[model samples]
Target: MLGIAAAVLFFIAFLINAADIATNDTFTSTNVMLIGLTVLALHVSGVGTGWGSRGRRR
Candidate 1:
């Protein structure tokens, strides 16, 4: 799920940067790319993979 989210963010960043779209300071392409990287890192680190709950006994 998160991987998909990251992919979408990357795509959006690419479009923004490649198309030369004008954006506000907060939503710049660089910022979107950075946020995507952060999300990817979190996904790689198992932050939201649901592994922890699966091991719990009912």
Candidate 2:
């Protein structure tokens, strides 16, 4: 899920940069890209993955 969200953010950032869309300081392409990177990092680190749900069997 987070990976998908990051991909969307990256796509939005690319569109904003490619189209030269005017945005507020808070909504800049660089900022959005950074946010996407953070989400990607979290996804890679298994933050939102449900791996912890499985119990270990002896």
Candidate 3:
């Protein structure tokens, strides 16, 4: 529940920033892709560590 709430808040904040940048013509596809890649990398790293720890515990 907390994770979902945080994700919702994050998405809302992202939308607000996106709207502001879009209005100013400052939002580029490259920037969006880079941000997406960064988030993906962080998620993968976190999940990998979590799974690895679980395997080691067995």
Candidate 4:
């Protein structure tokens, strides 16, 4: 559940950034690349890779 929440937050951040880019039309390539990388990293590390072990008892 924590991972899911983190993933959702990450996605919301990405959406906001995308909206900013769409409205301003002045966002740089570096900014876009960085945001993409951040989203990918968060998805893979926060949700995709760590999904299965999140709710188990030790």
Winner by lDDT: 2
lDDT, candidate 3, 9-57, per-residue tens = 4665577566765533344544544555555566655743345544545
Candidate 2 at 57: error in angstroms? 4.6
**Which number leads on TM-score?**
2
Each model's total of backbone clashes? 0, 0, 0, 0
Can you list the residue pairs that collide in candidate 3?
A: none
Off by over 4 Å in 1: 53-58
Question: Against the hidden true structure, what lDDT does model 4 obtain?
Answer: 0.57
Q: Write the per-residue lDDT of candidate 4 for residues 2-55, one digit (tens) a residue.
A: 445555555655775666644344445445455656666666666556457558
- What is candidate 1's lDDT per residue for 1-58, written digit by digit as tens? 7888999999999999999999999989999999999999999988889777556688
Instruction: Sum up the clashes in candidate 3.
Output: 0
Can you give the lDDT of residue 39 in candidate 2? 100
Q: Model 3, stretches more than 4 Å misplaced?
A: 1-25, 47-58
lDDT to native, each model: 0.92, 0.97, 0.52, 0.57
Question: What's the lDDT of the predicted structure labeled candidate 1?
Answer: 0.92
TM-score of each: 0.87, 0.89, 0.38, 0.36
Query: Model 4, residue 38: what's the lDDT?
Result: 66
Model 2 per-residue lDDT tens digits across residues 1-58: 9999999999999999999999999999999999999999999999998778679879
Cand. 3 Cα-lDDT? 0.52
